[model samples]
Target: MKEKKWLRTVLSFASECRMKMILSVICAMISVAGGIVPYIGVYQVIILFLDGKPMTNGIVFRASILFWAFICLAGYITKLVFYAISTMLAHFSAYSILENMRNRMADRLMKAPLGTVLDQPVGKLKSVIVDRVETIELPLAHLIPEGISNLLLPIGVFAYLMFIDWRMALAAVVTVPVSAVMMAFGMRTFNKKYAEYMESSNYVNSVIVEYVEGIEVIKAFNQSTTSYEKFQKAIASFKDYTLHWFRSTWKLMNFNGAVLPSTLLGTMPMGMVLYINGSLSVAELTMCLILSLGIVAPLTSFTVFVNDVKAIEYAVKDADDFLNLKELENQSEQITLHRFDIEFDNVSFSYDADKADSPNYKENSALCDVNLKLSQGTFAALVGPSGSGKSTVARLIARFWDVGRGKIKIGGVNIKKLPLAQLADMVSFVTQDNFLFNCSLMENIRLGNPKASDEEVIKAAKAACCDEFIRNLDNGYNTTAGEAGGKLSGGEKQRIAIARAILKNAPIVILDEATAFTDPENEDKLQKSIASLTKGKTLLVIAHRLSTIKNADRIIVMEKGRIAKTGTHKELLKGCSLYKDMWEAHIGAKQWAAGSEKGAVKQYA
Candidate 1:
């Protein structure tokens, strides 16, 4: 049953190319049958014609020549038809399966635990989703059906040989066991090497991706030499590993190549003995030669296919392992929320190692003694330096990761109890580094609320201060953002992300440094937009710029993953030393910049 289930995973994609599948199979059968006719029929005709003396002349001679020519012609036609159909089906099946798999992988990313997805390198995940999944296509579309077809040919050859003479049949069957043992030994060595080669390939891919993506930073920091050295070292290591693997498998491949022909040496000499002993006729001897010779090509092809299958073992295992990860449970339950009052009650949380690579942390202590409450329709800001766990707070509110210690409640219910889809609908997040899909500007904005109308999109874009800039572009909203909106300026991308958040219009909003990289000119407009947008929503903003959230109803100052201070921004500015220091620095910088500008103008005059 398990094996059947496994087969279904590979071939469930058959629905995509059912017509071609049926046609390919039919053509293959015709081609194999035609192959047998030429192998046996031509030899029989020659022997019969030569043996006749008085009867074989004129019409008989011409008829025999025509018959052989027709058989050869039919063989080539069937073979061509079979090959064309099989290749077409393979291409169609592979492309369709890859498209579906890529979408499935993307959906998996959305549903996977935040820690799980984030822990993986961008390159590693790219390899799995794009590269590894692609590798399965060849094995699926060609290897599977071809492997089954090859087995059938071997079976047919054995049966035909036996029917002609039981002794020859037994002789052919006896050779199979020896061949099987040699094939098995070869396969074992090849499998080990194949696995090692695949692993090294993934590592090499990761290094190449990282190096290329970081080229700009490396040059800016004068680390290009070091980065190149690291990249070269990784590539060299992979090359060495591949060479070692090839050395191990070379012997196996050579042995398999030689094994089938070696069986012929035994069969041909033995057939001569049978003929001399009056146990075999000339016809029988000729048939054995034809059939046994046909065996070598298919045997070699089958061995090559087997090796290809073994080579993909790692890719299959990697795909299966990724699929086997425990996704968030109860993701489909029905949930309804009228009010959004987020409550974190003694809610200590830690990155689960099963899902992430975390520091050596004591159990249940990412955030200790953490108690906070955000009332419905209020704006709250979390303020801290980097790694003070501010972003983690926003993540927990978003339910990206379940709280480890205490309950996180939304509308008086545990967040874990809420359906993931429902939770997603109820909350909207604008992350620090806003990710925009490589699509039309309109489509990227509509991603937040697919049901939203074009008018609604324009309205949201205006409220997020993005409409004016979008209109300035030649194609306006139709322009493609390119990968991660790399084509757009940083401020433009940030505003577009804000437009998405506006379109979502969820009861709860989490903004982690949404305006961190914007210029002052746009920042003012964005601040006004955010204030107007969150008037009736429960807002939790991870504040990178203190000036952006001075009007927040409450501010929680975090230190070392704990809430060091909590109050209104004004109160904290007066009472909290850390808050006071942060505010002073910000204010002093603004004043000093103004003074410097005045100084520079006076000196120029």
Candidate 2:
């Protein structure tokens, strides 16, 4: 029943290339038939000798021998031709199936919820897509063609042996039951061991990726030894688990290996006894030896594929788990709104819902019944310390995650009812840690608007103050960003991201510390670019630097996921104590920076 299930899974994956697989199977069957013909010819020659025919006709006897030799040669050549054709077809089908599976997985991931996608680690996803999926190729390509031929050829040979002498056929299979017992014992804990091995492998992959990504942090914090300890431990654990698994199966596997191929061990002795007792003929015993040898080779080959079957089962399960993730719910019908005003109506949320035991989990909420509205064309700035839910509010408005309670409306319609594409077109969000793909600078910006012309992209770049540095680069806008825009500075990457948002030209914009990386020298120029880009649009800006948002129409002060105060900068300074303390701190930081610069300049002089 378990073997049937494995076969069913294999067939399901092959459904797309079923015709090719069937053709391959047919060719394999032909190859198996041809492969057995040579042995059959050898049996015929032995039978002729034992018949006690007169040898005075020596010419006829030699002619008969040459005829059998030609038959054997033709059979072998046919086997070779069909085997080659079958393998080629199987490989083509396997690669096609892999391509289709990968494309479907990628499409499903795009539609899945952002939170669900983010919850998965990069290494885990890479393992499933690259490593796990590749494992399926071996079973699909070789197992179908070679495995089928191996199984059927042995059955055919066994039937021929039965025809020669039924007792000898039964005797030949005496070692099979004993070998099967050894194989069963070896496989008893195979599933458990494989699961542990997969877990250990995933852990090693995760730790290696994390270590490489955090190498700079490790150096800066003087934690090289400590960070490497975790990496070493993970790798050591994987090696130990792998070695333990192999050791546990070693004895049984060796026993099965030694016993399975020794089919003639019982056959030769049993046939000799039967012949001595005058129950078996010499010709029949000779035929039994040749047929028994043929049977063992195919049976051994079949058993080897049992391990490949288990690997495919596990890999398919992992791929299915990832492909089955839930996607976000949104209406298919697009709805055009009357205005771009945003409203948070009694909103509450928690990032910890998926992480019950996390140290950062909060029972209170990330946003507790927050109520606020931004009128169309108004500039709203959110100011608060870390963990105050400022970023959460921005993400909620952009629908990166659904609110835990209450509805967030855009133009008086629940955001959930809006088509995802339409809602995406309505807002532009520029996050602090923006990602840039490994491509030319122009191509990266074109991601925001694939249809935009080069001139339009250059214009947006100029608006975001990215044109100057981009032009100064060796290839101007054509310069590659490298991986994650590693070729550019933090401030430069931030500008490129802003240029993308500007090109989007949405009516509503959310900036979550978008200008935090900019130097003081470029701050004024970036603010001007932002004002130009956001003209006549509703803008929500989250900033820790209070001086940056002083000209806002309204300043919202958040504390512990709740709104503490909402007013203009001057109004908050006089009436809101929290806002006043934050402003004082901001002023002190600016003065300290000015003093440090003066000291550095005097020291240099």
Candidate 3:
């Protein structure tokens, strides 16, 4: 069954470029024919000499030599021309197929539930899309055309040998079964070893990416060399596994290699015996030797593709798994919302749905039986300890993941009924880890509204308090973000993200700790900019700092995935213990900051 699936995968991918593949096969067949013609020419020359033909002036010998030369020349020319054409067509088709596959995978990811995509590690996904997809190109570009020609040439030569002397033909193939058994033994553990190798490779990739992203933290803590140990261990593990796998297969491979191409071992001895007994003529013996030798070369060429075939099979399976992942159930109907109000009713969720049978599943629930609502244009704040489901609630309103049970509605309509694009237009979500592409600042902001004018972008930047810092940069608005905004400060990146959200001008906005990294000096200006951008719009903010949302219309304090209390600042202070405790912490931090500033001034004086 597994082999069937692998074959189906190969056929399915090949079917995408069927016409080109067929043309390539035709060229391959012609090339095979060309390769076999020289052997037949040699056979004919030997036959004439054994038929008692005179060697006068060596006329017949010269004519035979010339005939063989002309046939070989023409055959090779045709072979080169057709083979080149075949490869060109295959490569074009391979690239075209890869492009289409990547686009389809991207589209699938867009439609997939956020939780599903997040569950997969970044390194695994990269391997599937970049490395695995690229593996298919080898088989498509080289294996199909060359493998077909090589197999056919050997088969053709073997058939002619059988016609001349059946016994010699049988003797030629006597070692084949033995070699096959050796190869099968070599591959007995290949699948398990390959899987282990892949796991090690993915671990190495993940650790490398983690190390690079966390380099700042590592350096700040003076632990750069110690932090690098994890990455080094991962690389070393991969190397050891790869070498072990190779070593396990080495002896069997050598045996198979030595025996599979030794077809002439049996044919020469058997033909010589037949000739001595007056059963096989000298010409027939010569024919058998030459043909048997021809067969070995093509057979040896075919064995070289065995490892490539295995790689292609594994690669296609990996890519297919990702492409077939389940997508979120989103409706195609586009509905117009009447209001920007949001509601969460009897909502419960867990990240462990796929791992429900595991022992760790019980602790994976992120939300449970939570209920809440926000009126249109209301500025609501969700305040909670870490892992209290504050961010989950904000993400649910944006349909990042469907609730495990119960329903979430926007404007009194089930959010699932709205088209994804339409729902996206209604909400602008800004999270702390904002990803910026490597492009100009102007272009990055424009991503919020692709059709927005330059003037509009500049206006949005000004409102987000990003204008001054952007202008101070060497290229102003045209400066590049430099790979995930690495060139900019944390506060600067946050402001740029806020600027993007502000430019979007959506009716609803969700901020998941958006100001967590901003400095106190920049916080006031950013808050004012946010007020202007979200004036009269429904805004939901998840804040760790109690001071930031003190003036919010309502504050919902969350504890253990449920709402502990909901009220205004004064009401919450009077009734909610969690709220009061958080407020006290915020005030104490502020006092500490004031004291530190005063001591610095006194020291300077």
Candidate 4:
């Protein structure tokens, strides 16, 4: 039953290209039968013409030779043609199965919660998606039709050898039991060894990806050598483990290969013994030898994939586990949100390690008995120190992850009742680290409202105060964003992210350090754009700089994982000690930055 698990996974995908696979199997069978016809025809020709008691003239023998030659030629051609067709069909079905399986996995990952997707390393997920999935092509493309047909054909041939002479039949298969034992030893621990190999490969892949992605930081800190050393060491470790894995199985695999295809060793000698004992005639012994030789070829091909089943099985199970990952609860049907007020009711939350996607997050309690509400059209600002639960509050309202305990509702309805798409359509989240696909600036902005026209995209860009710089570029709005919007500077990326939010025009917006990257010169313009856009919508700002949110309708001060106070900024400054201290710190940082700028100007002069 354990051995059948991987095969079941492969066959489960067979429904995708069942008809093609069936045809491939049929062609494979015909190919096998075509192979045997020539050997049988030779046996017949020798039996009829060279029987010890008979003699035929040269004219008749010449005619017989020509007939047999033509028959053998025809049988050989059929084998080649059918085998070609069978392989072509197998490849088509195999690729189709692979494509369908990949798409399904991708869809599953997308539907899975952000935290669930983040729980696994990028390298392991990619290893499963790209490398592990590719391994299935071995069984699907080469092994299924060919393996099954070859296996079945040998059984039928062996049965015929049994009918010919039972003792010769026993001799012919003596190698099979020995081969089976070798196969058992080879496969006994294959699943565990293969898993270790994959883990090392995944670790190497993750290190490579991390090294490349963090190259900017690595150089900035002058840790290039250290980073490169780490990457090389990971790669070296993976190589050593792979070589060790192969070395461990080297002997058993060789034994199986060498012994499995030597049926003639037993049959040839046994047939000679039988002939001497007079229990078998020349015709009977000749047929047994011919059949034994024929049987070994297909058996040899079949052994190549016997142990490989272990690896493919493990791959299929891993993929199945990923596809079954937990997802955030969401309704299937869309429900209208009559109001846009954001409400968190006694929400206590923690980032569970088992379900966390972000490396920076932990099992630490993020929010403790938090209760807050932002009315429709209210401008709310959250002020807190690092890890004070400001961002977690905003994220829960946006349903990044469901609160561990308590209800987060938007418009008087629990967020879990809202369909994922409908909820997504209603919220626009802009953060310090915003993502932009590799496409034109126009398209990137249009992503917020995919149906927005060219004119609308430009209007949003102008509103975000990025229009002037965009027009100064060679392609204006048509220029590509590059990978993750890498072509743009930090300030430029922020403006584009703001432009996207403006284009979306969602009723509720959460801005977590949205102005962190903008230059002082453009900060005012960016604020004006945000102020204009938030005129009648609920706005939540998670700000580090207290001055930016001083004019907000409501300011909520956070300490640890709970709210310290809530009031207008002026009231909080007057009444709250922590808020006042934070304000003083913010002022000093600004003055320090101004003094540094002035010192630089004096030095230049």
Local distance difference test scores for all models: 0.74, 0.83, 0.81, 0.81
TM-score of each: 0.87, 0.88, 0.87, 0.87
TM-score of 3: 0.87
Residue 479 CA error for candidate 1 (Å)?
1.5
Q: Write the per-residue lDDT of candidate 3 for residues 244-362, one digit (tens) a residue.
A: 88887788878888898898789888988999998799988988887887777777775668767777777777877777878888788798777889999888777766654455543
* Residue lDDT tens for model 4, 182-247: 877777887688778767876898899999989999999999999999999999999899899889
lDDT of 4: 0.81
For model 1, how does the per-residue alpha-carbon lDDT over 1-605 read when each residue is reduced to its tens digit? 13235445545645766676677667666656655666555665766666773274767766766877687678767666776676667667667866766776677777778888888777778777778778777876776457656766767777788777767766654556677787777666564566677677877887899899999999999999999999999999998887877687677667666666565665677788899999888878788767777666666687667655654555555655555555776555676776789998887777864422344443335676688999998788899877788989888887887776788889988888988888888888887688889999999999989999999999999988888888988899999999989988787888788789889888888888877776656666666567555657888888666766777778899987899999977799788999889888877776765332111101000
Q: Rank the candidates by lDDT, best first.
A: 2, 4, 3, 1
Clashing pairs in 2: none
Tell me the TM-score of model 1: 0.87
Mind giving the per-residue lDDT tens digits that candidate 2 earns over 1-605? 24456456446656778899889999999999999999888877886777754366677778888888899899998899999989989998888877776777787787776777888887778888888989989887998789989889988888888887888888888888998888777778777777788778877988999999899999999999999999999999888888888888788877878998898898999899989998778887888987887778777875668778877878777787776777678799998799989999998888755643455444558888899999998889999889999999998888888887889999999999998889898998987898999999999998879999999999999988889999999999999999999999877898888889889999998888877777767665566567656877898989887777887888899999999999998999999999999999988888877432111101000
Q: Point to the candidate with the largest lDDT.
A: 2
- Whichever of 2 and 4 has more lDDT, that candidate is 2
